[model samples]
Target: MVVKLKLEELKLASVVFHHLWTRRNGLIFQDVFQSPSTVTTMAQVDHVMYKEVLTKDSERTARRQTNEFSQSWKPPAWPFYKVNFDVAFDQASGRMGIGVVIGDSEGELMECLIAPKKHVPSVFQAESYALHRVMELCIELGLSQVCFEGDAKVVIDAVNSKEEDSSWYGQKIEDLQQIMAGYPEWKIVFVHRTANVSAHTATKLAIRVSSENVWLEDDPVEVRRSIMDDLVCNVLNQS
Candidate 1:
């Protein structure tokens, strides 16, 4: 018996059958015989089956694209003499801290973090706040080429990809993007937590300080001192 199938339906059915056969399962002739009406008249099932197949194909295509994009994506490299900044925030104490370590292709040049009191709720929020603070610091330092590093993946991805604009912090993300746009050269990077230790310490200290007090320094003496003391204590205990 000849069946008249829609062009789209025939293509979809061929695709579906190819996939099914690849799994080592042959089509059941008995099933087709049982559904004689459907098998003999493509009009009986073509429209519904075509839509279902189309949707499945579309979803598969989208997933493949997402995977490809992720695998190929890489952060831009820092330029020579670029100003690099690391920022951290404390949500509990509502304090934001930024540790900027400027360097060139040569080596480390300068470093600083500001402990400013502000109300923040979560680590993610603190990360974003730190980024905003870094931009301000960059402008203040009169540096046009700057790179920012943060431990928070969410914030970095939001700022770099421009995908977070539809989220809760969408407005803030857009604002930061605009601010960064003013600079001829600006880059944001996601770094390992270990590399961000100084900024993390600065953020903790910043939260401890009162709102009236804002700690600004080129060198983070207090944080360095605390680390030294911890190391010394550990050595003494081992002895």
Candidate 2:
């Protein structure tokens, strides 16, 4: 019959049983036998190693769970600002729509911009241009400590990398790197689409607006709602 056991007790019993099986195999296959004391010592060593493996597995599981719960927008640390950028494209018109959102440590909107660019060669160029626009705006606004975020993993990775990019958009990435070098405290990060709702919404808005749209401490209704939803998700996840 089977019975439930406390974690430690079960682990000890499993290790002991495993080593006992190994000892039996040695007797049959190799015609070798060890004393009871020797077998017990081997089992004890297996138990210690098994416990260490279990501990590491438990730690990895915990870290993964934490990351899953934190899949929403979060405020930056004190004295720092967070910027999120995104892009949308119209194939028919060959125009790329760009959106950028900036927020303070309190999650309060500082500024936002939605602009349309025409004759962009590719989506990669569009994403890269959006990041470049962010750098210019941050510098113009005099934001010294800023954390730039985007849903474009490729663009973010290229910006963070030290190696030279030789792709079609390599020159743009190089220009961005040179500009970013002047501000040592600024950084760019990649986030999931769900966590970048506000900026993504602004990109959708860019499709309708004829000229560039800028908001100071406020945003369009759709973008504002998205930001509020992020705040709500952040609070729920924390609680």
Candidate 3:
């Protein structure tokens, strides 16, 4: 009977069998397998498995998915930065807040923005405006490569689609697409609320202020803790 074993299971089974054989007889795998070449093949399989899935990086990824700190801002690739935006809406006061924070590949804060919008009717409107600020900043800074992220699925879906625009913010969305068309390396994505805490903090701060604010290099002390927490998370993932 031929026993078909999966590649992973075969490697595991061979490794276990070899370990036991070496210990029991005080001899190497060559004597147990009766094939000198088998030792090299098993060692190669172990090495490949270690590099592919059994390494420290892979283990950390699994832990991150299940851990409480799973919601984290992922760093962009080199030469590209990530912009995370969020909106705060206050229907009672007829005001909206747009927060945009940019981070580099090393998880350092590159830029921060707080734009307080009036006449903003709904959450969707606020989110769309936040998207607008994010792109406008990217263009002004001559950042051609960027990753725009937000927690609002409605805004992300509408912006990323090439479909006909008809929403209340459709016109502005079209305008954003045109501005972003100049930068082929830019993209918009939606992330979990947890991963969007930094931008949310900025939005909350905007509610207390009356004017548009921009931080080119240093983030305000109010949002520093969240940024520090995010940087710490990134560092832990590397280990």
Candidate 4:
């Protein structure tokens, strides 16, 4: 016959059993059963253990539901369009090249390259030159509201800051400031190199190619071809 005993007493016995098991090695249940105090302690321990297991299972189930709900949810749409540009300077040749890609909320609109008249010596200079040319292009295209992004932090900071009058690139800085002033709703930002890879590749190609300039829409094949050519040349030269 099965007997249903009070769980409170069983739990007390379990608690005593747990303490004895932890304190000594090779403990036998016979020793615990023989002691009246130990039997009561073990009953309490078992009750606590059962409660803890139930609590843990409930918590795990709640977490699983929370994760599922989060995964099923969608985020709101972004409000503004973003444009990214990159510039590469050939210090030895003194040639400056610029590459820009414009995109709206829908998708990419255009990409272009400008081979400057004078060779730019530093990456910062090339970046500034690229920004200037991009602003000019935007004006030509009749775009009023846009944002410009580049990989050069120093150039971006210089464009955004008021502490001008630096000896190096003073004229170029002033020209950029004037161009920026012309646009009422334009912003400049610095993007990481990885994010600016396409433009960077285009800029490098612009510098390497014999043609004065190359422009494309929505990352065209010609642009990719030129970039691939540059990559092949680089790899071959290294080998």
Candidate 5:
């Protein structure tokens, strides 16, 4: 049985449990249970979960969510850097814009990267190259524990797959897997464009720079505002 909370009663609870979901969403999702213990960090909930068999088709409703109640740009736990990447293409010059943004545990910007490429044939190719470049940047920084995400569902799906993807970007996916294998722990997931707005905005900044550029601890004026917006939203989710 579940207990109901009064409008006033919820104000006194240690933590309030909101929308519930099953494990089949294929997300490294964090959930809260109304246990007697006080809620602290996300990792604290791991001990309360159990495995169960579920029909594959039962999760359709979970995937078809409307944007009304969703939260975007969720922050990572301590010591882990969360990276989000996105790509934009210019048809006039056949150039692609790629953006990568890294945020630390406190939702503070760590790095911002934007690059442009010519002769990119499709969005998938641009996204694939963006992922490859992001991984290379992470490797160069010697970052091991990380959570990598992107707004492109197709690209994120292929990056998270263990089996070799045979689509048009087959070789690109293969190379990404090889680079990821070196990390001790990592995550690759897809987020809605709403949640990935900071990275998406950085892609627009690509138009300003003539070549690849990296900025540490700071971003362009537009992306800086976008990052700050996500950071404030993160604080609201925790409260």
Candidate 6:
């Protein structure tokens, strides 16, 4: 007999098998018994996290191999700050992670946020929410001559579109436009995921945290490493 499984089905089976093995070990050594629902939920979460890691790795590789000269993270001009935003969504849990990082021309981290949003309807909505929230933050901080960057091409295109948006997230896009109109010096652009690694790292970290955390010049080690990677790459590209 031959068995055929779709890509998603194969991934689900793998996650389920891994979780079952873990449960078996727990039962044998720890005398712990988890219900079927609990096991299934664990498998689902594992699958989501595994996929996220794989996606990020793939994006990083692709960005490096691409011929695009603008693939690397570049610092903004003097007196202008670059704000990068990214989102990670878990459809199984309706939870979304939002990351925003601000850096100066020297590629030094200025401000960053790692937060989670519950009941996010979809990935598109989640990305839109991140962008909107970052805009609010910039306004609150009185930041001008800002360059906003994100990995969501669709959201970036939508925000830059002059035509009206009537989709579910249209209102949010309209709000973003209104906010942009007020700050004429502010600009939003799309970037590859690898170029937004710090924000993306913060986004992944957001999923593990329960509350919003903001840092000023003090980012988590993982996020700090990403910023350093960008800075190093910028230096190499310049030389």
Q: Which candidate is the best by TM-score?
A: 6
Candidate 6 root-mean-square deviation in Å: 9.0
Candidate lDDT values, in order: 0.53, 0.81, 0.74, 0.59, 0.71, 0.84
Clash count for candidate 6 is 0
**Per-residue alpha-carbon lDDT of model 3 for 24-83, expressed as tens digits?**
443452343324444444344344534543454665677678774555777899989999
lDDT of 5 by residue, 73-192 (tens): 988899999998888876445589888999999888899999989865345567778888898899888889899988666667867777764543567778888787878598888876
How much is the lDDT of residue 39 in candidate 4?
A: 36
Q: What would the TM-scores of all predictions be?
A: 0.51, 0.70, 0.68, 0.55, 0.69, 0.73
Q: What is the lDDT, from 0 to 100, of the residue 118 in candidate 6?
A: 88
Candidate of highest lDDT: 6
Q: Quick one: how many clashes does candidate 5 have?
A: 0
TM-score of 2: 0.70
Tell me the alpha-carbon RMSD of every candidate.
19.5, 19.1, 21.3, 26.3, 17.5, 9.0
Model 6, 1-239: lDDT tens digits are 98999999899989888668767876897787867776776576456656766786786677669854657799999999999999989866779999999999888889999999886535666888889899988988889889999877767887899988554356778888998999999999988776888899999999889999999988999999999999999899889
Residue 76's lDDT within candidate 6 is 98
Candidate 2 overall lDDT versus native: 0.81
Worst 10 residues of 6 by lDDT: 41-50
By TM-score, the candidates rank as: 6, 2, 5, 3, 4, 1
TM-score of 6: 0.73
Candidate 1 stretches with Cα past 4 Å from truth are 1-98, 211-218, 222-239
Residue-level lDDT tens digits of model 4 in 121-228: 344556677787788877887777777776666667777889865444656778888888988788887755544555666676666666556455645565555434
Put down candidate 1 lDDT per residue, 113-184, tens digits, no spaces: 555646443445566776777777678777676666655666678778846444446677788888988875
TM-score of 3: 0.68
**Distance (Å) between predicted and true CA of 16, model 6?**
26
